[model samples]
Target chain A: MHPTSDKFIPFITPETRHFWEGTKLGELRIQKCDSCGHKYFPPRPFCPKCSSKDISLVLCSGEAKLYSYVISHLPAPGFKPPFSIAVVELLEGPRLMSNVIGCPQTPSSLLLDMPLAVVYEKLSDEIILPLFKPTEKIV
Target chain B: MKNQKLVVIGAAETTSLGDIPHLSQVQLHADGALNALADAGLKISDVDGIATAGENPITIAQYLGIHPEWIDGTSVGGCSFMMHIRHSLSAITSGLCKTILITHGESGKSRIPPPEWPWPPRPGSYEGQFEAPFGTMGPPDLLTIPFLRYMEDYNITVEDLAMVPVIQREWAALNPKAWFKEPITVQDVLDSKMIAYPFTLFMCCPRTDGGGALVITTEERAKDLPGKEVYVLGAGESGETMLISQMQDFTTSRAFKTSANRAFLEAGIEREDVDHLMLYDAFAHLPIYGLEDLGFCERGEAPNFIRDRNTAPGGRLPVNTNGGGLSYMHSGMYGMYAMQESIRQVRKVAAAQVPDVKISVAHGIGGMFSASGTVIFSNQPN
Candidate 1:
């Protein structure tokens, strides 16, 4: 059943099924290159660093810092009025682009170098989108 | 005796830039290709290599009625065709093809009426189900983050950034082929529509439909060609990532920095040696970032340089002589035109060509400053 606020779907792609299954267990999963030891987003079968097929999925620290972000005021079809999309350079050093929730979507609100923590948005039954919110919710 | 040369023997464009309601994208591209070939006194059979950006690669091939030995269809961004010219030179140098036809065209204006892409909403994709839902359709609005960063990093005022579209509008006024030829002052740019914060409507390159092409050949073949021969000196390319959000630096284009340095070094030239610069100005703030990245100004000093009129027609450097993508026309593809402008200046054929253009740098950034291709050209054979 869908939530009154929004729905969470747990649909998974072939390459990321394991990752999603892990997220379903309340863990943030990331893949690190076994050969080069580099981490990456948009998880792939092979490591982008050294193109090594050998990689491992590991739980990640959801805490992160704001790398960059943009807020949109103009309205589009599906999304709510406005939101700030960002690249969260995870404290683990792997960068992931996700929405920063619980904050006003404005330049003044989405400060670069700001401290934030992940907030998982259960989009559908199978899909768990990780979002970020400022720790202090600083005004 | 095996050493051959690849020179730009011909170039041409549509008569004007605007909503080309009459022609399809492929037709527009073909018209430009035929015109460029005619300028070189050549025919379709003369072109063995076809490099293009955007859709309709085979349509152009069939329309021209030739099976090309090479089809360089890398849609890196607006500046890709300029990169293609460099790649074409490499192809010729490596004995891939002698006569090459490079082109850009699109009914970008008319294409808007088509339905949205049939592809499903991709959550991982920053576009579609992500940014598009929150508004951010394309170009000007999407460029807002970098626009803000430019101001934050440089202490530039909105008026200083407005100088781009304003000055470009003046140049467009002179080019009969320009889309919006109306003259605009800095006040007009600031006063125009505001799409995003700090960026007004006039400060952005408009969406339009048009086509342009260039035919390059080797120096050995340059002996018999009647058209003015422009030489390809050096080229470089770099990109951090296809996705905009993942780039390590937001205020700067990593591709632009790496590629510009590589371009100059390969050309065996220094920044001071370049006489004319053709930078892709799809967004008003782009040229400012590019200039700083290319070392035309000290870090954070591009606005001051613009204030000094360094890039204006009568300034120390003349950029975008043919109105640039801002005023001329942006058919969602500007790389070929970037190459075309450099060739025109080198050959002294542009309507606004400066008299002393020796080395010209054509810069292009694609996909949210992800892809970069830099080319340095000269009249002298290198």
Candidate 2:
């Protein structure tokens, strides 16, 4: 497993360790409530809806649609400048906010309601960050 | 189901609204509370009920000197004190307690650095540890997300966003208590440095130092004693504060709309019905965003809604008559000042006071977008 320690640190709490580990294996994962079959994000233990502990980890199809995005040009501490942060609505329903790479970083290239697909990169010893590239440009 | 009624009969404020080196946060609160007690013609002991937004040296029950029969510490936003008026109204009518006092103080401006107190934990601390790590630090920056979306979807523009601080400065020109009194123009706002995209330096409220106190009681208690009586006709509170502060989705501010709706409906008023409007301005964009959210205008049209000085001195709603957080003293929080401004308008003593204010709507938002509270003030009850 490659770790991206020099680039950024992944927040590893007891609840989200599995999702991080799955990223290392090149698999996209999400939690589904066993009781109500609800899919959740950022990974959580009990079902937020019913508080039921019954849940299962499932691999999600690495596809989503771009709902919204911001083209930030300022230079921050870790993340690269001129990067675009996006909120991608998974085909499942819940929206995940993350940065989109692999596509040309330009305002015109970043269209609303654009289709996106996720690709995980193992950068270093203990890190795996997901990057989304424009695919299908769902317009 | 009917909601509770709250009325503010007496109040007082500190004139030394700048840094006063010797006074502590408790002392600041004490100064305001003491004046409030005098305004109500009530003693420290007379206020059996005390309410606060957070724990302070002046606890509802342990302020300055005595204890009260009941205590309520409800802190929503700049509207927290106003919300207490709603609470006190119910408590007084329900035979709970009499003479409810709400107080606030912070040596923000006068002191080089302010002092901390043995108070409650900071509200919305989650955003800092979890959300801020990936950006979204302050309200102005975080809120820019929605502003960007508004730019994409509506007529609101960078120039429109500039109007917020421009008007705030105009009001501050009349308000002596305001920290900044210089006359300004929309061009000045456009010329200021950008704190973030679509928002300039003037687009944010200044950090102010001051305290506000309001005495809430029922008609039975108001039969005697001093000062002008300001009645609360409607009040409500709501939030999309749970998972995130700013409405991450940017569709709308459900919390703001929900509370404003209840207050307006209960007060039996419309946007055009009210003569005065006091919307929080911690971020100048707050009113611009709130105006659109509260139905004063169509979605994505906040920029054009406040195009001119119509809502200024002689304009549409006569908003933020006290200079607001931008020009007026913001104190540590915007809610306290909002309450103070409402009372001033009701008393006809505002530096920028408007005429024929039979109805007033005040709005406040906590955290980045934690919770929003609303109160409708009228000359009479519903």
Candidate 3:
């Protein structure tokens, strides 16, 4: 049987290139609808809320609250077992899926609504993945 | 479209329930369709409409030598078959086509190396570009994120979640075809190897090789059919955001509420009217969400309801009597199995039949709570 790979490499699309590129500069970029003032994630040209084409990329606070998370024991292409995958509610009011680093991947450690900050890791020259790390230092 | 005259005259699952290595995906579809046809005492030529998921409608048609006047390939996810049931009701009622055949088949466990057909997601697609990049593998990984939030918001303990699989396994014990017939306890579920946080191995549905099909036609045609008539009382389908993170609420499912509410309103029945229930149990959390979202129980009350044995066999509400996807068979998309069990209960021929089951409701979820479909069936024509 072929073993599942642990490495995760995302394809950069034209619509989402800006968000990925922003990670390289240690910034979290999101789309804001100029007409309706709706901020969203997974970059798109048009606003999903009001269907407004007038949208622009803006850097977010890079700070979030842990909305939910899971510690996956299954092996992936480039990931080790017991890695925590999380959905963090951004300070700018959007939610994104990412891994929680800089902390133990445990139910007791990964508390819900805990404060988190974005941290960038250079996967390759063209790719910079943004992950979350707990802001509160573990004793 | 309330109180439509459409009826389901035939329903049958594949000959084998689990682990058939010989049957290819296309062959499984044919096997299900043929079994459903035989159940209806009809021929392939009698089927004028065909609907399927996980494969192209044309491929199924051409392979089975069927020339359908209407075809629908609505591939949402596991709940695609439920959506097909809703769509077929409209098609048959609108005089678009008659004798609709909806089939589902997946070699989830036995098939090594995913099939190359159906093509991978486009690199530019939102899932491909965003969700897939963060090591989101499959349903187990994607759904746990929301479920974790649900557990926290509702103050549900891991032991409460374990009750889902434990109760379902109790029902599976009475089922001869259930994959795991042995009774499992809450401790067993908690002790099972953890796949994702809050989700142990038993909480996740077992992968199996199976398929099922349902045949629906007009009331007039159904009157002459050999099988018992299971009339479609009401049907509703709705979709939420595609991504789990984009969902407006993590604790409850909006799609499930919308679809089930619409179905109940169309059927002109109250929650008390349903005698049997089948909620797609692709994971243990699904039924908990289904119970609340479908209005059978209040939000944050489902875990308690299960612990009280309200959904187990002999309970007030008998759910997943076929053992569900957890203990029965989960061939990737598990909606079809749920539908089949609902039909069997309505016909009073299920292996673990609910006493006096006149009204049955089958609810399905696709993707990671991305889509929902609810269908209400009755033995008595309303």
Candidate 2, position B55, lDDT: 46
Question: If ranked by DockQ, best first, what sequence of candidates would result?
Answer: 3, 1, 2
**Highest DockQ model number:** 3
Specify the CAPRI tier of model 2. incorrect
Which tens-of-lDDT digit does each residue in A62-120 have in candidate 2? Answer: 88877665555554445565666566777776666566677776657776667888887
lDDT of each: 0.75, 0.69, 0.87
* Per-candidate DockQ vs. reference: 0.26, 0.20, 0.66
True contacts kept of 3: 0.69
**Candidate 1 structure lDDT:** 0.75
lDDT of 2 by residue, B265-325 (tens): 8777778877888888887667876887787877766666676576787887788888888
Identify the runs in model 2 with alpha carbons over 4 angstroms from their true place: A1-28, A32-38, A42-88, A97-139, B1-5, B18-21, B56-63, B76-78, B107-130, B243-249
In model 3, the Cα lDDT at residue B155 comes to 91
Q: Give the range of the ten consecutive residues with the poorest summed lDDT in model 1 chain B.
A: B112-121
lDDT of 1 at B224: 85
Q: Please tell me how candidate 1 rates in CAPRI terms.
A: acceptable
- lDDT of each residue in B1-382, candidate 3, tens digit only: 4445888788999999899999887788899999998988889999999999999999998888889999999988888888898899889888899899999888888873465422234546776656665777778888767998888898989999999999999999999999999999899999999999889999999989989899999888877889777888998889997788888889999999999999998889999999999999888999999999999998999999999999998899999999999999999899999999999998899999999999999999988889999999999887
Candidate 1 regions exceeding 4 Å error are A1-12, A22-26, A34-37, A52-54, B1-3, B112-136, B140-144, B147-150, B153-160, B183-191
